[model samples]
Target: MVVGAGLAGVRSVEALRAHGFGGAITLIGEEPHRPYDRPPLSKAVLLGEIDSTVVDSDLGALAVDHRPGVAAKGLRAGVLETTEGELAYDALVIATGASPIRLRGEGPQHVLRTIDDALGLRALLRQGRRVAVVGAGWIGAEVATAARRAGCEVTVVEAAECPLAAALGPVGAHTAPWYERAGIDLRTGAMVASVDLGGLTLVDGSTVEADVVVTGVGVRPSVDWLAGSGIELDDGVVTDEHLRTALPGVVAVGDCAAWWSRRYGRRLRVEHWDTALNSPEVAAATLLGGPGEGAVYDPVPYFWSEQFGHMVQYAGHHAGARLVMRGDPVGTRWSACWVTDGGTLAAVLAVNLPRDLMQGRRLIEGGQHLDVDRLADPAVALRDC
Candidate 1:
């Protein structure tokens, strides 16, 4: 039984069946709607480019015992306690996903996570009203871009020195002008001290007025259901190298699961879509048989953001490393590589350069070190590194 039908849960069902486990697979989701792709919710769905109906429905054609609209409240060693009732399971996969971090305020604030949230914000966009976005994280930045494209006056408030600086770091976030050039009033070092019925109050006593308020602040794992489970929980569900929790028959995956990383030697939780896709296979493999060998669930984290006609891609983990800017940071096309121990490739951030990311990703996987100039040079194939 899988308690959550988001990306990881859906993929787990397929993986379990593929691994020749023909057992009954019951996939439970708290949302009334079936599982759908979330990455598009902020971009294509917000643009009204996709049909409204399609955005609200399932994309994967898997036949699930999909218990939509049912919420799982708790997890025992071998049973899932839901709003409906308890169900027994030989092997259970927990993919209860994450929810958008609700910004502090009074009247109203929008978060761009679900199709429902997107639809509500889209309605505000169609109204042709001014939009104020607080926080310049990935979602916040994307929504600000969408709001600008929609012809609404957009104002972005960010407390960070630069957009995504904390995650992508200083050099990557320096691309703030892209938003400014797109007619977004990008304000940095601006904290929202208060939010009113009309606008958000900045720390400097100025107010950002808007018809609709949106905050793209971070997200929190939806592990409220596992309150007294006695399984380890920190920022997310803590699992071992095998994706197994402190308790047996209970495994967590997706945004809600934080597992020990062999590469970095720490338990880290990543909220990207790929992590959701990758971790469940390991869980299923271990549950179906043994660990001699399940895949280590160590695919370099990768994610892309589309803004201002540029395709930005990032590969691999970038914690505790010094960033090496290979290409021009101010240039339209460039690559930034984060090297660990101030040397070997740990991750690569590329803008409009898929080849750089592809090559750099390989170097990171191989744990190789080579000429920095050789990899940085556009003429040289980074595969040589």
Candidate 2:
């Protein structure tokens, strides 16, 4: 049995079948619609470039008993409690994913998460509409981009000095200018006091009048249902290197699972499409072969964002790593590499440099040591570095 109809949940079901699990497979979700891709909700879906983001996988051909709109209320030993009733399972995969963090505000505030959210926001993004977006993270930037494309006057609010401060730290300063170049009103170090239909007022009493307000302030793991269910929960559902929970016969994956990473020597709960798409296979192997029987679930995390007419791609974890620049940040194309004190490549961020990302990802996965000077040279290849 699998809970969650998001990418992680659906992929979990597919992984189980691919591993030869022929028993009764039941998939449950809280949303009424079938499993769909989420990354497009902020881009193509909002731009009306695509009507539906539903995944192309055929549940019927896979023999999956998909039950949409049925949410799991609780869990127990070999039994799952839902809004409908309790169901038994030999093995379970928890992929409940995460929910967006909403701000304290009144009136209609938009958030880009579900398909309905995309379409609803799409309607409000007219030529003369004023759109105020809170938070300067990836989602916020994407929302601003879509609104600008729709001819809406966009204003992005950020409490920090630069966008993506939490994720990229000082490296985010490079992106601050991109917002201005795109004609967005990028206000940094401005705290939002309150949000209403008219607009949002900052702590300084300054106001940003807008017809639509969207919040993109990250998400928290949807593990509240697992409370008192004997499953460990910290930042997310705590899991071992094998993605197994404290209880036997059960494992977690995707955004909800903070699996131990042997490479980084920490527990990481990556809330991105890459983790949801890849981690399920490892969880399925652990379930089929029993605990401690399959390969460890540790991979170089990868994610990308398209905004301001540039493709930004990042790979690996960059905490506590020294930054190495391949080219000028103000340039149209460049790459940033993070190297550990041990001279090993830790992470890489590429801006309109796909080849650099591809090579850097391979180097990061192989744990290769790189010469700092060579890495800083734009003319040199990542593999040679």
For model 2, residues 257-276, the per-residue Cα lDDT tens digits are 99999989999999999999
Which 10 successive residues of model 1 have the least lDDT summed? 51-60
For candidate 1, give the lDDT: 0.82
Number of the top TM-score candidate: 2
> Which residue runs does candidate 2 get wrong by more than 4 Å?
290-292
TM per candidate comes to 0.94, 0.98
lDDT of 2 at 90: 91
Which residue pairs clash in candidate 2?
none
lDDT of 1 by residue, 258-332 (tens): 998887788888898888887888988877875435667666778888877778889888888776676676778
Clashing pairs in 1: none
